[model samples]
Target: MTTHVQLHDRLDYQSVAPLMAELTAIADDMLVIDAGNVRHLGTLPLQVLLSAVRTRAAQGKITRLAHASDNCIDMLGLFGFTPETLTQPEAWT
Candidate 1:
């Protein structure tokens, strides 16, 4: 089954632990991350997302991002990532 995870508006350092825990809980399932509300994508949260993507890929599950906001897209771009690129596990490596 595909599980949808909705990202917070402020994905800063404070959100890392909670986000990681949420993602980890769904590690065995196909994931679709909803990024439409994301206003700030901090490095730590980005790392958490990357880790989740890699883990899902290794387990032969899919991880995708959906409905990304413009700010979220820009923030990802600053780190050389797009919502599409984020889903590719190889990109993280």
Candidate 2:
């Protein structure tokens, strides 16, 4: 089963640590991130996200971003992540 992480609006440095901890604790085969409410993206949070996504892929697990907000998508794009690419883990390599 997939573990769902509900993202918030402020994913800044103040929140990244806890968020990263939550993400790292998931033991499911798939991780589903609900980014619909993400309005701000900070460098730390973005790094944490990229690490989680890449780590999951390296382990042959899935990391999915479902219903991401426009702001979230734009911020992720800066790091080379498109909605299509998010689904294709190999593209992240």
TM-score top scorer: 1
| Model 1 whole-model lDDT (C-alpha atoms) | 0.92
lDDT of 1 at 37: 100
The TM-scores of all predictions, comma-separated, are 0.94, 0.87
How many collisions per candidate?
0, 0
Q: lDDT score, residue 28, model 1? A: 45
**All candidates' lDDT scores?**
0.92, 0.85
Compute the lDDT of residue 77 as modeled in candidate 1.
98
lDDT by residue for model 2 (38-74), tens:
9998889877887888888878889888998999889
Segments in model 1 whose C-alpha atoms lie over 4 Å from true places: none
Q: Candidate 1: give its CA RMSD in angstroms.
A: 1.2
Q: Return the lDDT, model 1, position 79.
A: 95
